[model samples]
Target: MKKLLIIAVMALSFGTYAQVDPTFEKEGDKVKATYFHANGEIAQQGYFLNEKLEGEWKMFNENGDKIAMGNYENGIKTGKWLFWEGDVQKEVNFDNNRIASVNNAKTKSPVVIN
Candidate 1:
């Protein structure tokens, strides 16, 4: 009896930990966003179409600043991607999962004197 009870408890615990959360997906007419995380901070966020990433996507830093933005088509990156670090910004051109060029500001753009 004790051995059977122990086996049941272990099965329950394993089942709980192995469960996977469902991702966002379009239902009928509305689109949804899904978040992937670690340590309670958002690691990735994007629209989900049929449980796959589709359309524009934005990634944020732990402090919540916009870190990167790009377009996604059928869960694959398409078009251009922009990345930023502090005052520096870089633009990367992408073609069919390949990076074509990267342009970075050699010197910071001057503030507009209004």
Candidate 2:
């Protein structure tokens, strides 16, 4: 029906612009940030120092599944980061904010297509 079509169009339009601001909380010397997706689900969670990204960060998909996790020092990437890709996991090492080495390992995990 025409009414059904109009309602569907409106829903899609709203979804296209469904942005929500991230919430921040103070924790000791760092500010904890929780970023959300359009559906109000947590997209990423991390800490910030001096208004810059600091410490460990975890990224999730819309379904609340972790897709990536890593660490940062004074906003610079550092340490090990894990990323899920299909049935494999990419383990990356960082030094000086750059890739130091990469190793691929097999794992059964849920994957989200962006």
Candidate 3:
């Protein structure tokens, strides 16, 4: 599920590069990264540990609107992830790098899989 989701996102976002250079900073044992969009807006910001994504990460649109927010553990998706799609917000729960459940906030309906 995770792989499929990633591939779909990649396919959808064909222009996913920033013209400006990205910046990175060291925060104790972790490194903080801030990526920019082509128009210089912050695309995403997150922390990495030992070259792997760790802790909370946030994604934003070119106009500076936050589009998604989630957490990672040892580079793997974990816990609840929220994504904004048009007028709706989608919540996905992940366990062991796999989706456990998904809820559409606007519809108030949840889709769960064992």
Candidate 4:
């Protein structure tokens, strides 16, 4: 019906603008991304290049606190990375572009607090 056609056109137009251009390699490749909490205190953003995460990435908690930060090389996590959950600070090691180990701060009594 004519009404159905109109609705379909409207939907298609909206979808086209709602998505980010994730395909940065070849021209005219469709790519999409979603950003969280744009106006809220906490904001998180990420992107997909050619449908793969191929750059720096960041994440934050609802309270506007940084939760994690790292990079993606060809969609694989690589290089130094840091992760924070609540009050805990963790340092992660990577090898061959993969996570090797994670080190967290140790808690100690007053006598050994360093």
Candidate 5:
């Protein structure tokens, strides 16, 4: 029992410091990057131009589920971003890091015929 407790403590301690390093690949003048979660799952992925976030980026939750996806230009958020919240999916459009619009889609209930 003592040995089991020690192993559990070690595992928890390691999890506390778990980190995922980003991998970069050169593409012309920009570099593409993929960041992983502590569980070795992809957390976020996008491109960098001049060392700034650019192009399309995707973010996932720790469970490897897509949480948000959008585009960036020179570290500025642009285009539409989709986010998952409970049973609803929210779409946010950004322009130059500013929110331009928002749309939400929720589950619809079906009607029963008499």
Candidate 6:
């Protein structure tokens, strides 16, 4: 019975530590967002301007690996972005939220693998 009680307590503690829900905090007009993984790691974090995605945003996989990073303006994708898939890195350019160009580089750059 003592062993059972210890195990139950451990399980509950670990369970609470494993999963953390995402949180959004208001910062003036922008909303700061933070998303968490099942392992309680940060998955993505960024800010929303005027209720739209704005500024730089970073995305990570469940393993807490950065997979993609880019910027937004008024909820529209703009500028250059980088994405990672295994050993390859992809650079994408956006124009008015549309794909303007894409460049794939075979380099050993650590990136989030989604």
Best candidate (score: TM-score): 2
Weakest ten-residue segment in model 4 by summed lDDT: 19-28
Show where candidate 4 strays beyond 4 Å: 1-34, 37-43, 105-114
Q: Tens digits of per-residue lDDT for model 6 on 1-114?
A: 999999999999998777688899998889999999877778999999988998999999988788999999999999999998866899999999999999998889547877
Model 5, 28-47: lDDT tens digits are 99998999988888999889
RMSD of 5: 4.2
Question: How many angstroms is residue 88 displaced in model 6 relative to the true structure, after the best TM-score fit?
Answer: 1.6
lDDT, residue 81, candidate 6: 94
Better of 1 and 5 by lDDT: 5
lDDT of model 1, residue 4: 100
Candidate 2: where is the Cα deviation over 4 Å?
1-12, 109-114
TM-scores, all candidates, are 0.62, 0.80, 0.75, 0.53, 0.76, 0.73
- Model 4 lDDT tens row, 58-103: 7777577888878776678887778887667787877767789988
Off by over 4 Å in 3: 1-18, 107-114
Candidate 3 has which clashing residue pairs, if any? none
All candidates' lDDT scores?
Answer: 0.73, 0.92, 0.91, 0.66, 0.88, 0.91
Off by over 4 Å in 6: 1-19, 109-114
Q: Model 4 Cα displacement at 72 (Å)?
A: 0.4
Ranking by lDDT: 2, 6, 3, 5, 1, 4
Once superposed on the true structure, which residue ranges of model 1 sit more than 4 Å away at CA? Answer: 1-31, 36-41, 106-110
On lDDT, the leading prediction is 2
Model 3, residue 72: distance off in Å is: 0.5
Between 1 and 5, whose TM-score is larger?
5
> What lDDT tens digits, residue by residue, belong to model 2 across residues 1-114?
999999999999998988999999999999999999888889999999999999999999888888999999988999999998656789999997999999988787557766
